[model samples]
Target chain A: MLSEFDLIAQYFTRPPRANGQVALGVGDDCALLTPTAGMQLAISSDMLVSGRHFFADVDPYTLGHKSLAVNLSDLAAMGARPLGFTLALALPEARAEWLAPFAKGLLALADLHHCELIGGDTTKGPLNICITIFGETAPGQALRRDAAKIGDDIWVSGTLGDARLALAGYRLNACKNDPDEPLGGQINLDASNHALAAARMHQPTPRVALGLALRGIAHAAIDISDGLIGDLGHILQRSGVGAKLSVDDLPLGAVLAQQPQTIQRHFALAGGDDYELCFTAAAAQREAVLTAAQNASTKVTRIGSIVADPGIAFVAADGTALDLQLSSFDHFRTT
Target chain B: MLSEFDLIAQYFTRPPRANGQVALGVGDDCALLTPTAGMQLAISSDMLVSGRHFFADVDPYTLGHKSLAVNLSDLAAMGARPLGFTLALALPEARAEWLAPFAKGLLALADLHHCELIGGDTTKGPLNICITIFGETAPGQALRRDAAKIGDDIWVSGTLGDARLALAGYRLNACKNDPDEPLGGQINLDASNHALAAARMHQPTPRVALGLALRGIAHAAIDISDGLIGDLGHILQRSGVGAKLSVDDLPLGAVLAQQPQTIQRHFALAGGDDYELCFTAAAAQREAVLTAAQNASTKVTRIGSIVADPGIAFVAADGTALDLQLSSFDHFRTT
Candidate 1:
């Protein structure tokens, strides 16, 4: 029976750790942060609801990590450095067990990026976690959605589809939708691969460094949260351009690569929640792009090229248009 | 059925109207804001959930206005001017009839404060609204809770207790807990008074102008979402000081004034959700405080003085200590 104030003081309240940026922190009417001179502040918010966004028994540690990670990804997409974040949490009850690990996981990531937990509100209700993150970028250096050129090359960081594959496998195995299938109707994945996929799904490493490096190197950037094709469509819509993506060049880890060709392509292109950086850069900046990737110690693969035509085309190895109609997961459509 | 994207685009999206400060607005991974040089960004978040914060059938319009108003009140307490905000919404379903009015109320308030709707995530779930608002104040100009000094005069803007009175009357009437009461076994209030109290509960005017004018004039400040004594306890705790409050001097509008003396004092002292600005200033600055209130066109009343003692004493008009155990609403305790 912890009061909301006690709950906040115990689990959420922390000393102001983001020095230089945070002027005032928690236990105030409003937290204050001073933006660096010549820098623009980038802000975004995301909410995760139980049952809809995560399972009731999902690991609180992973849940906490995912909550802030998604927000940091937004800053990453904008090529902004993480500054601080405020969390608004609603809980059915204040269980110390869940909160301890949850706070640990959340703060670990925050500490890693120097994104202090500045201020937040906690209330008793159905479980919901909303985080609003702030970041900063120099006046004109932010990677924007509308800045892509027609002839720019489209690139994706790290691998894609593993998280979605993990989700699909877990759903197939746990729900046993295909009752006639063998092995308890479960799509059994190798233990290591399953773990990797699950880790990707649960604990996405935001591409903060890669994004900072790509600030001037990339023109338009977006984080791959709604799968590659759909998120790329956002850039296309904003920049008023088209893209030609080669299925052959789509980045995939060994686990995802071992899947059936259709499954691999589907998951790689339309499976959401990868949380990787996708960007468009000038073809002439190929060397610079490589240098930036090397500087970040992250893998960057060119997967497509932007075109003047105003529609996306998925191409095969022979340059023929793929006839497959794969669409990303839309929350309303899925429901 | 509306997908999350469509819901956001139709109900939440708008052309970037917060021009000069916003570098990028909606339709991006993150909204970018350029704070004025030598200014500090003030940030605060608030969450309102159905059943917990409001009735399920509460007018979507008032809910929208309130959802943002409460957050704005936090900024107002800090003497911060509204800049922009990000909304994270969870809806049980996408009902246009409900959403239309909700968005209208929300955007109207945003327009009034020039608080741009910058970026947010919309999801399908239990109805909840969380808004994180951003504002700015110049260096050393923002009002703070810990800045109160012993001997500083305590002042409250506008009236108090109407919202709490409204809640109490509604609860008492609907529940009929006291069968001994008259008027169909329920306490009765006149129509006009009830309407005034209800409006106070529903749409609190955040004292933004008074707060802006209080910069350098007020030593410490807080907006009374919680009751006077409880919220003022925050300033006491932070400032390491206590107060001697004159219950007689507590400001009350006609509706609250008509209540029984005990009930009036209880609600005015410890009943929450008033949203009026309670500030502290040096006794010598009385004239300046009056000037600030005059400039903002808001009423201000001095009710107490901060003392070096570590506990509050509510005194009677005859200088006798009032031994009333009035505590503010603690959500967990209330539940």
Candidate 2:
């Protein structure tokens, strides 16, 4: 059996890439990093367990990508430029077949963003991956959740509900037509839609460039990890404000739109793991906000407006308030 | 049952202390840290799991101290000053009783070192704790394992083998002697020795001050986590040199000194979790090294010297080379 050190040396310890931020990478007690002058370091941590975060048989490569991607999303929400990350992994055993692809997926994204793997620990235990990411941002430039102000327009990047649809398809096995379910009214996804949703679920893009572009334009920001409404609620709570979200304007991918209207609304409002940035910007910056989205090569939809009230209100297309009981996934909450 | 968010807010979240290094701490998507200009960031991660790293019934307070202590030790080895840390904790349940003392112990040490708890994730899973620590060092001033030179004196900070002795005593139940094996001689620790060993095992100081002091005086340094000989071997291998260790000169605590000679040697050479700094310096710098240690208020013992040869030699008091099979703990080793 390969030892933890051997595994790390063989797979994780690559020659340091020419990232000036990383002064020292791996092979030492600690890695040394040099943040740019006048830049504040943005750091975040995320942990993923086998059963809780993903299926036991989930693709190792996708698991690797999602693990780092989730942590990167936190940085993205903060409008920070990725610098380096450390992975603390606990594995049941040292299996080369599983590790090779996992490293590939992890490093591919790291390379894409110019983020280096600085240092981490490997141990033998239940399969769990914890990543702590470091990034850099100019002082007072981060999109903070407590910075939202009255009359700011709430915006969301990309489309939501696709990942949730992908999950629902997997859970209900609805990718295939089931004649017996004609009366059961289960939603079925076509192969093309299925592929789109699955990709959205498995390999999320962290919208890093979009966040960087929104650094100065957005008043407050948060990533849509625990659905749009719940996450936006966090911003509102922190800012001591509220929001009025337009249900009809909520961005929905074509695949998610084909579902029942109620399902579409539910998934878009409450399903988690979208990994898209939700931010609020002053109405006067509308032109600049659109330019920022274009510069980052991402789409942004104006979904709501911040208000002085203390709770969220959902407005339907008919101008009637939509009352929906919704809650995000709480780890300790009993089903 | 407390939700993960509630648990974090109740137990882990605290007001940002007046550490100017932390720009933004807990309650954000990412913690913002400000590293000193012209200083490099030193980062390290360590994970501890129940049943594997500690006893199932280990005190949450000690476990908390140890979980963060081990990671800080890595920074200490690099001669970095503690800045802040992120704790990713996966707990089986959110029990207030267990969390209270755990947080108390963790924050007490953090306060001592001025290391703020920046940000991290709390999840429901098998009990595990992963801490990623951040520190700062002057550019190129880190004490590295690859910097040892030939003929440099090897020095170790503080005493060794006491933690291992405590472990053995606990494993062997030495406090309650068994009369059935009269011929089986096992060293018994008195109350004072037991207290010393237990304290060493439960709450290991990271030697951060000593490491910071050794930056210019020492050529190479490492924390003796996996015993002296094995960890020193890392320095030798990395520095392209060997060492000649005089076992008679090794600093032993009072408890370890009372053990049989063989047991004392074995514990000193192969035991793990000592968390003491082992460093090398030029022979001419011995007085400076002693002064550095004195400035840090830590004891330093010169035990060996770097040699031109490629293998370590252990010599007895009579100058005879000793042949003993010693190996450090390998997590994946089946035996």
Segments in model 2 whose C-alpha atoms lie over 4 Å from true places:
A1-5, A174-185, A190-192, A330-335, B1-5, B174-195, B330-335
Candidate 2 TM-score on chain B: 0.93
Q: What are the Cα lDDT values of the candidates?
A: 0.85, 0.85
N/CA/C clash count, model 1: 0
Q: For residues B71-137, could you state the per-residue lDDT of candidate 1 as single tens digits?
A: 9999999999999999999888888889989999998998988889888888878888899999999
Q: Can you write out model 1's per-residue Cα lDDT over A224-264, one digit (the tens) per residue?
A: 88888888988998999999999899999668887778778
Task: Single out the weakest 10-residue window by summed lDDT for candidate 2 chain B.
Answer: B175-184
Label model 1 with its docking quality class: medium
What TM-score does the first chain of candidate 1 have? 0.94
TM-score of chain A of each: 0.94, 0.93
DockQ of predictions, in order shown: 0.66, 0.58
RMSD of each: 2.9, 3.6
In model 1 chain B, which range of ten residues has the least summed lDDT?
A: B178-187
Candidate 2 on A1-335: residue-level lDDT in tens?
33464565468778888877788888789999988999999999988887777777889899889988998899999999999999888888888888988998999999898999998888778888999999999998998989999999999999998887877766557334444222125576777888888898889999999999998899999998878887898899999999999999999976899888877888888777889999999999999999999999999999989999889999998889989866655211111
Q: What is the TM-score of each candidate against the true structure?
A: 0.95, 0.94
* Per-residue C-alpha lDDT of model 2 across residues B284-308, encoded as one tens digit per residue: 9989999999999999999999999
